[model samples]
Target: MTHKDILLVEDNPDDVELTRLAFEEANVANRMVVAGDGAEALDYLFARGKHAGRDASQLPAIVLLDLNLPKLDGREVLQAIRGNPATRDLPVIVLTTSAEPFDVEASYALGVNSYIQKPVDFEQFVWAVRQVGLYWLVLNHPRVA
Candidate 1:
């Protein structure tokens, strides 16, 4: 029942726009905070760099991560999140285009809550986003930090 922010760690502009549209169309109430790359996402999560003034205690409800990214890359970002006690339990969904078995296995091994391949079709993508919102934002119960 508690509404928390959603962190979107993605570098592609087109994908970002599509995600935004999907969330909007799905009527997801949580605010989406975008980080263009892995480093930026980490900065925001840890309250460093441009996000220095942010309250680090207030973490996002879930993170939608893309494997291919500039700077740190999603695997590194996932490791960092898991390594940090403050963010270890935060739900992370790997929303990526990669359908590779290794990628999926690696993500699961790194403690990703879910892994979803990006649908090429607009409607399918929207449906996936809606399902994600419904599950992570509305249904799942996270531990109170």
Candidate 2:
């Protein structure tokens, strides 16, 4: 059986490494496609730029997006995803450090499926990642493409 990859759109190296470790701790071994910034995430999703040759039809199980990013912000990326017909229905979860109500409201308006604040503690972070992985990859039934 093949495991569906998780699309992680983040710029911070430490956060990226922590996420990897968290997933590993949770036993979620699915391959992770890490995009350093929002523009690169868009490229991967739309099969443009360096990802032009990738199979655009096979979107990841879910997208874990960070709001603060370079090249393009997560809000723009979320808008792009929702605007495009092909990726409109894809599950996108906002995983960010921001606890601002405005940010939460804005993300929801942009069509994020869920909004989760990053856990500061490693154990809590690992548990959160595990739950998200299980729910999105296993329990949640996305619409058939």
Candidate 3:
């Protein structure tokens, strides 16, 4: 709503750069705000701490979440988001290196919109990120206010 296309919650810098490159390659002119940890992600979403006074109505079209985070972690973050009425239906995609069956099942059970495994190869990773960005940014219809 605030001209941001995606909220990418990731701690790794390399992955973040790769994702940015992929989005650029896709030509999606989206305002991306990066949160290094789950706590920061919540702060950004809830407009807490440094995000205080920010507009809460400016929810991103999609959230690219990583499962393993420093503080709260992705599972707790997802739970918090789902528990909140304001962000209850917000679309979330778990994009991480985790491909464990339990992780996949848990993410799905916890109401993730989608789960994507990070590709190891650089080119493949870029391609995957491009696909994700294109789909979520261009094709997906979020509850735009």
Candidate 4:
């Protein structure tokens, strides 16, 4: 099996840096791809726009998606991902600051694999990332695409 990378869809520079640091602290060796917004994320996944010619079959092992994003929101992104046959089964973990019940329910309804709230404390954030890496990268058995 090919080594799959992780896709992080976020608009915040600080959050992006924090996620990178957290993954490093967890010793997760998988490559990380950053999309500044939902549109970029879609492009990356679909190999369109600037991501043209990318191997569409080489999908990310997991997607850490933020609920609030520019261009298109995370919910819309999730809907698109699930709507497409090529990316319908891709694992998406909604990593955001929102703890609203509606958001959680809607994400599940859209077929998100997991939902995680961003931790305010740096250490907690690292721990959360570590757990995510351990479970999704190390243990989860993904469906054959």
Q: What is the TM-score of each candidate against the true structure?
A: 0.97, 0.98, 0.93, 0.97
TM-score of 4: 0.97
Candidate 1, residue 134: the lDDT equals 94
Superposed on all Cα atoms, the candidates' RMSDs to the truth, in angstroms, are 1.0, 0.6, 1.7, 1.0
Top TM-score: which candidate number? 2
Q: Better model by TM-score, 1 or 3? A: 1
For model 3, residues 27-101, the per-residue Cα lDDT tens digits are 767878899999999999988988988888778778999999999999999999998988888999999999999
Poorly placed runs, candidate 2 (over 4 Å): none
User: Residue by residue across 1-145, what tens digits does model 4's lDDT show?
Assistant: 5568999999999999999999999999999999999999999999999999999888999999999999999999999999999999999999999999999999999999999999999999999999999999999999996
* CA lDDT, candidate 1, residue 101: 99
What would the per-residue lDDT of candidate 2 be over residues 1-145, giving only the tens digit for each residue? 8987899999999999999999999999799999999999999999999999999998999999999999999999999999999999999999999999999999999999999999999999999999999899889999987
Candidate 1: deviation at residue 95, Å? 0.4
| lDDT score for candidate 1 against the true structure | 0.96
Clashing pairs in 3: none
lDDT (C-alpha) at residue 39 in model 3: 95
Give lDDT per model, in order: 0.96, 0.96, 0.88, 0.97
The parts of candidate 3 lying over 4 Å away from their true place are none
Off by over 4 Å in 1: none
Best of the candidates, lDDT: 4
